[model samples]
Target chain A: MIQVEHLTKKFGRIVAVDDISFRIKKGEIIGFLGPNGAGKSTTMNILTGCISASEGKALINGIDILEEPAKVKKMIGYLPENPPLYGEMTAKEFLHTVCDLKNIPKPVRKDEINRVMKRVGIVDVSGRLIRNLSKGYKQRVGLAQAMIGKPPIMILDEPTVGLDPGQIIGIRNLINDLGRDHTVILSSHILSEVQAVCERVMIIAKGKIIASDTPENLSQHLFGSNRLFVSVAAETAAVEKTVKSIPDIIEYQIEEGEEIGAVSVKMKAAENTDIRKAVFSAFAAANQPLLMMRPIDMSLEEIFLDLTSAEVEL
Target chain B: MIAVYKKELKSYFYTPGAYIFMGAFLLIAGLLFSLQNVFAGDSNYAGFLSSLIFIFLLVVPILTMKLFTEEKRQKTDILLLSSPVSIIGIVLGKYLAAVTVFAATLLITMLYPLFLSFHGRMDWAQIWGTYIGFFFLGSAFIAIGTFLSEVAESQTSAAILTFCGLLASWIIDYIISFVPTSSMAGAIFILILAGAAIAVFQSKAQDWRISAAAAVIAIAAVCILYIVTPDMLYGLISKFIAWFSLTSRFQRFSMGILKLDAVIYYLSFSAFFLYVTGSRIENRRWS
Candidate 1:
């Protein structure tokens, strides 16, 4: 649904998005993972036609944004980090205005507004002025505004940021439901949210797309899949001796156990090694009960933090 | 475009901006109307409109202060900018909405002349000609106010800047009276104008090559003109100021001399300012 080619955006001397390129297919839910100032919002703004890129071009379904912005904008809905809302307007009025902006037929505008309000669950507060609405309601209203015309693509920047945990779940579910028909590109620092809702993740740092892959593949690729965590009810010294004796053991850490006289340990085996059997037998031979043994995969948060901080070759 | 117009118009009414502008305008107009025409038994309705011309100077900024600034500060411009609507549509929509409020207020004030008609004879052509002039003049001011609002970052600063801009227009004729009429002074002033233009272009484009090219071209054009016909530079500053002076041109309409050029002047002035406003916004995305 979107193709960005060598896109770069410069604000005076500062490069906000530099030489970044990516493509998103139809019906794909992609998460943009980055820390603050990671060119995520800049990329979203360029795709939505809110701002023009300083160099290169972006295509929305083969439509050039700078050449035919109005036509392209009609196909994409954007929810900026700060919801673009008028405090004087009610939620219904705001949505109606958005429908007009999107050029929906007058006959269908009423139904479209109502359906979107229902979808975003803002129908009940449609009559209340936006100034009186709470942050969660306001966010929903912003979402409703973007969904009013049923654009094929939705670019939501931190869509679930200010919502309570329950509300976050609700919106996450909404985005998942929306993924059936809409191409979703959402940017957030919340790694778990992205992991839960997105099929693919693009990690951006310092204005570059440093990595792009499925979350699981990223973990497997970045850190080889042989790392494991094991806890045993035994003396720390004995656990260390057994860990040293275990073959294919690359690196390991001995950690304090929750129970007295037991030790918790984490270890990384050699490439492609299934250290589980070796770890089990090693602990059994020492007469130490193996309380837990599981391979430890990298979570999205660690991958995001580590990738943004240092260079990682794919 | 209609959506933007309706929203902006409704906002003016919902906020106290339209009411305050119209209230102050009509109150002063009413006081002036009753005192001059009713009490003094004057019959010149055009005189009343001409005398009330000062109302637009104070009230136009109130009508236009938040037109673009509010959308920007609230970040609601993202909706408008990201939508399918064109920048011209948004600018014209907001401009027309502000004009509509001023027109509606002017229509109410028309009842004053109708009241005078009940008592005695009135020069209907002169009355309406002045009304047309006042409408165009107020529209021109609204356009300036709109441009200033776009330049300012907040509503308060927009209003203050617009007020100062309009007030400067009110005193432009006096300011021009003191400008030097010598060719040297005019050439110097033109050079300064070119320098300012180059400065603005340099800051926006951030490209020394383009700005330097523009500066070279500007200087060359001025030098050629100076060498070709130096007389053309004499009193050039006053002519430039006079060409841009909205109120001085409005004097022709107030005199009941409906010159085609003056009407076109008022319209073109408003169009020019509005075009600047549109460019200011359109350039925002690129920059």
Candidate 2:
């Protein structure tokens, strides 16, 4: 339900978001993957109407944000990088304030806030001052603030940055649950969090969208050759010799296996080649038992590094 | 807007700012009341009301220092900006909240006059008029503090800057007395004033051509004024100072003379500063 066209943001001489364009459909959970200073926050800030873009425009449900910010802002809930919280106020009071800002009716504000607090699991700390809460609770409070009005879209920047591992999982599952009805857009440094929670991934670098696709497609399409890790019940030298005999195996690294009297070899095969059968046969001929073999797929972390740093062509 | 107003008003109480301001204000007002009316047996409350402007100058910064600077330092401005509330709503909401605190404190001090009414006859009309003037004057100072709070980076600096700004206003008449009132000096002063105004407009518009045109037109207008009525140019600096002199207008209010123009002057002065504060906030998003 959000469309951005050639949006660019400049802070004096530095370009934060440079002519990047993307669209997010309704009920789609999109994850922004990038390193620090990748303009992810800037893009989110522009879309949320917190800051104006230097060029182009963003439309929420076909309404220009700059032209009608109040109407557009009503449809989007934003959680900034730092949770915009008043530490002196209690969590419940903070949510009530957010409801008021969003123009939620007074009678239903309490119920709405309680529902969100329950959803984000911050109900117990709702009465405690936000400043006294731990970081995890504060983050949940931030998330609860975004979910109070149940707006159609939620734009969260680095939602799981400082939370513990368990809390991170809870927030990830919460985002996944939220994606059932809400269009979820979150940015995080944790690759696995995005991979687990997002339906699609957009890799941005230096204010440019380098790649956008599903998690599986990104790993499969960006990876040129097949890589296999095989364990053979033989010495390292014999495993290396067998690996050399197979011309399909372009590169190989042999190391000792965890299994006694065995060697594990990681090998890269030619494009689309199935070295599993060849390795099985070669090891069988040598009277060496083939213990295990499996193809290795590139992880999202590698793809991100490749796209962001190496600037790999799609 | 109501939400922001309620939150800001409640926050003032939640922190020590409101209490400190009110405590300090009431302490001084009480001391002055006891010393001037009780000890001196003075029936003149106008003098007492006139001296209360000093209280506003001392404590207005406390009431306004955190209006925006704290929001910014805490990064809570994001919540306000990203919400459906307009910038004008937020500014007015905060502005009115500060004014409300100042008004409530003023109301508490009404006991001073009520005690005076117990003993003998009092000029109720003049006393009420002075109260109105004091409210407006304090409001004008609060507006100035609100604008400076947004301009400063931190609360301490905002408070210090606001205090200095109000101090400058207090001494504006004295400064005007020292300035040369010759026609040549007035012409040059008007030219400098025009230049400063054009410079502010240039910074906001960021167009050299428009700014240059404005500067030329303003210079040409001043030159024409200088040639046409050199006599009018004399003492022009004092006139300009009088136009902006906030305390000078207060003298009329304290003298039991309720001038409509002075009331409008105080109101317009507050509105002008508040409008500039709103523009400064809107410009923040672009920057």
Candidate 3:
């Protein structure tokens, strides 16, 4: 339930967020993918009402943030790039303060705090000062702080930036868990994290949104041609001739295979075209046994690089 | 606002800030009280109360330096700003928290007056009046300290800046006496002030038309005053500076007289600075 229209933010002469527009439906988990300084944090900042946009507007549930910030901000739970924490306070005390800030009723404040602490898996460290906790625990506390009021929307900026791999998985699972009831918009440079956790990914580069789609669709759309990698027990020239004979195969490359008298072939066919049967029959006619065959799809990481790097070239 | 107030108040005690301020302030105030009253057998509590302002000037920085600068340095302001709380609410909450610590410490100092009352015939009117004045004056100073804290980037710098600001206000009365009293000088000073106000307004509003209109109106007002009544402009510089003399108004209070205007002056002074603090914070988000 968030909408941004032609939003732009300029810091003096430097534009931090160029003209950008996007909408997120209720309960949708959206990820902002970008390298550092790509306006990911800036956009999150604008959406959370932590900062003002220089032009255009952002709305939450049809309410403009600038027009009625208090009402709009009440609906959002934001975890900034740096977790906004007081070092001297314990994690429990910090959550209590957040509950107060969120206007959580006194009667239910403790229960809410406990629920959030357990949800973020920080119940063990609840009594410890936030400063003494490890990085992962501290981040969880930040997450818990955001989740205290159970707001409808959660905006996390690089939620798992400094965590260990296990912690990263923990946070990703936590986000996925949140997605069941909350609309989540998180930003990160880690492509696989977004691919694994988000229903949609928006690639932002140079203060502009370059691509927005589902993880699978992004890769499939970028690499329109279907690719097949095959290994055949035959001479390299024979495999190459057999592959070239397939009318549906638009491009082919034959290389010597690792095994003796074996050749590997890589080929691309038109979109939605299945050249597997044609290649099988041709290879069968040539009496070259097919050792292995598998379809190759571009990974999210590769698609991300291809898209973001293309922006740099422009 | 209550949430922010409680959190800030708790933070004050959680760190060494409140203790340091109260300890240093009480130690010095007690030393001064003992020297002026206990050993000398003097019952002139007003004199001791007046001297306590100097001690307040020193320790107030400790009470206020981390109010906002620490929040900025720690980046916790993001939490406050992103919450549903209004900017005014946040500023007022933090301001009241600092004032609460000051009020609590001032409450302890009541023992000094109580001891004097037990020994001699204390002027209750003068004592209570001075106490009220001292509270408001200290709050005004805290407001200044609060604004300085918001302006500086670090706690150390905020402390230094707040101390310097209080020091300037402390000596402003003395500085006022040496200023030129000639109408021409007053006219020139008023022009400079108007120019500075216009510059500040221009930076904040970014509307040249409003600045130009303000500049034109200020010049017109000054010219009319210069021509119609030069006498009104005589010694205007000192009078203008005296208007901001926070301590000068304490004379009425110390003499056992409660002037309504003086109380209002202290209150409005605090309100002015607090309002400016809120605006400064709001401006930061936009910038």
Highest lDDT model number: 3
**DockQ metric for all predictions:** 0.83, 0.83, 0.80
lDDT of 1 by residue, B1-287 (tens): 89899889988987898999999999999999999999999998888888786777877888999999999889999999999989989999999999999999999998998999999998888887888888898989999998998999998999999898888888888999999998888788898998998898888789999888888888888888888888999999999988778888777776777888888888898899889999988788888
Instruction: Sort the candidates on DockQ, descending order.
Output: 2, 1, 3
User: Model 2: number of clashes?
Assistant: 0
> For residues A2-115, what per-residue lDDT tens digits would candidate 2 score against the true structure?
999999999999999999999999999999999999999999999999889999999999999999999999899898999999998999988888888899998988889889
The positional error of residue A84 in candidate 1, measured at the CA in angstroms, is 0.8
Q: What CA RMSD would you report for each candidate?
A: 2.6, 2.3, 2.8
Candidate 2: tens digits of C-alpha lDDT, residues B144-229: 99999999999999999999999989889788888889998888998899899988988888999999998899888889989999
Residue ranges of candidate 2 with Cα displaced over 4 Å:
A256-261, A312-314, B195-224
lDDT tens readout by residue for model 3, A173-233 = 9999999999999999998899999999999988999999999889878785488888999
Residue B230 in model 2: shift from native, Å? Answer: 0.8
- Candidate 1 is graded, for docking, as high
Candidate 3 ranges with C-alpha deviation above 4 Å: A230-291, B197-224
Worst 10 residues of 3 chain B by lDDT: B243-252
True-structure lDDT of candidate 1: 0.90
